[model samples]
Target: MQPETIKTQQPDLTGAAPAARLHQVAAFAGLSADQTAHLAQPSNIERSIADHMIENMVTTLAIPVGVATGLLVDGQEVMVPLAIEETSIVSFVTDSARKCRPAGGITTSMSGTVMIAQIQLVHVPDPYRTRTLILERRDEIGALCDACDPTLLRMGGGFRDIEVRIIDTAAGPMVVLHLLIDTRDAMGANTVNTMAEAVAPRLKEWTGAQPLLRILSNLADRRLARAHATWRPADIGGEAVRDAIVLAYRFADADPYRATTNNKGIMNGISAVVLATGNDTRAVEAGAHAYAARSGRYRSLSQWEVDAEGNLCGSIELPMAVGLVGGATRTHPTARVLLAITGAKTAEGLARIIAAVGLVQNFGALHALTTDGIQKGHMARHASNVAIDAGAVGEDVAQVAQEMIARRSINVETAKAILAERQSQRAD
Candidate 1:
């Protein structure tokens, strides 16, 4: 087995390098000498497959990974690593998480980590009868599934059960089979997809229908994550601030146009952590949006309400289908570092942390929207990007950004003029 690397994560070892931090954390946790040594090695991820993992060996895409600290989930403190280019998300969420530290932080839960695989069969003569036949032979079908991945079966992860549905479409009726799998540590896409295809020949024979489109469904409603948090009125500005946040949520719930933007803000935080963990951001994104519109109306995935004690209560529920093993999570070295930083040992723990982070993020965002507005804190950070774009370097970048925010003229042109003036002064 490859050696493990423990990052230094102590109160005093804040700015230490990765190796140093790992040792500190190991010592702090009272790890054995051999275990600590095993965890202190550097990460190595080479070409695992033939161009499937990294095709053409192009340059890597870069996203700034920032630590959102002071978040307490289930009574344990965790630092979330967020990878994104958006402004103000990490800062505000970090602030809210810090303030929420004393209030027991965030509480989270999850349904079973189950994923769906759809087997589409068209041209069925008796769709209902076909459904019955498919359900009756679930054990036999499951056996075929387990045969494809003996290792997964041995690991106690395999096809859990099967479901058959007969739906009437424009042309005719189609028999859709839903295969549910307990994926355990992995996402189980390939495992379940393989299971679906293994039963295709039998499904075709049993129903006398054509089997097509056997794949995993991104609408992972079966696997859900939820988080709940409460912020006192005095803690979050005042009672008016809490009520205003509820009003903002009402606005999103009333219209799809606003709801899209609202949930996008929520994902602005969720997707960053999702990417940092090396999970499928696209799949999570698809599941989130689909779940948002699951009520036949595209609405916010979060809810804000005023409590009797006048504290602001925030809760969010979404289809959070992430994994600790398989795909990029297993293949990427940086992903390993970030996951370690988050201290999520299992897929379920990671899901809970992600959901909690998203909730705190939404909480911070709505407070800003209801009070000082999104542009102030958001644009202040945008100023730095504008300065960089205008060719400002080092100290000049900070000066130019400060000037842009002060003058309320944050644009590429303003940054360039200020940079030129600073250079002229230096020359003189």
Candidate 2:
């Protein structure tokens, strides 16, 4: 599962046939011929390995894996795999990544791989006294949490600290206990949940209060990853475009409605990478949205600014609770290969790369939004899908799409008209 140990020379999938690309990546990763074929066939019987990974004995659900090229992160060229069903995301991020590559690519910073477990204590009589008692018993609570998993200890990660918070609500005053654990290369849901359960009885014992909701917090504020990129104004169509992008950011910054969509644009890139790398998208999304409103107002996750030299600068900081170990990240054929292709050395590196992708994606979106428009390039890119939808197969797909474009109308109705005429001419 350590992609850093991939000693074989990497494969360049440029111009490879789509149908054959899966096996090509498998071979590049030094898998056996059987594993290579397994990558292509979801019904290979090998993928649905019964009862171990999941339930109901169903087959694997597959999504088209598209690569966003030209990303130079941390001085290393990376091909990011996106598992999203949306159009223009891969193209947009790729566009920005290429534009900023000459200016030293992207620099990133990540906080610790710590996850939080919450022990909710209800019906506390003396809240202040209970808080003091809980703080004094920090070692006992931390020791009980650390004992929940032996393997987590072997990985050089274990319980770190405990925090107590007293909240007053309509129901009454309640004391909350927070357990911080370094789960190390794991998404840490199960690990932190186990610790919370293990320490729950003691938590109830010490405070003479009811312990409920022993679980990990999805608002992973502690495990944050950040990325920044700078692009010269001339390189990105001069000062007007730069200021326009900043204005585009201002619109989002000022309005919650615009900010949600703006942040969704960034998550379009982050979520795809998360899905591709086999992380929990729902948890990541929850944390991201919660982190967005941490300042009491929802706003964009990224900021656009002009540097002293008039170069456009963009930065993004968000919760990235991704991991390299366990779950589908290690077992899923495509996910494992994507990690290798990404060439990230650690979980932090993986997180940094994802954050950088988000920043670049936002840049492309704003750049397009402030200039021509989003749909001009996006619709043109996806017109072939519309052509296919209109029942234009094979040779006629491109033909119908081209005609639709020529007519300046790229939709189902337009595509169908082009196909019908083309078919009539063929019959004639």
Top model by lDDT, which number? 2
TM-scores of the models, in the order given: 0.89, 0.92
Error of 2 at 67 (Å): 0.8
- Return the top candidate by TM-score: 2
How much is 147 displaced in model 1, in angstroms?
A: 2.1
Model 2 score (lDDT): 0.84
Model 1 clash pairs are 4-39, 5-39, 6-22, 6-39, 7-21, 7-22, 8-21, 8-22
Looking at model 2, residue 165 earns an lDDT score of 96
Q: What is the C-alpha lDDT of each candidate?
A: 0.83, 0.84
Tens-place lDDT digits, model 2, residues 185-215: 8989999999999988887788788998899
lDDT of 2 at 154: 89
Give the total clashing residue pairs for model 2: 0
lDDT of 1 at 384: 90
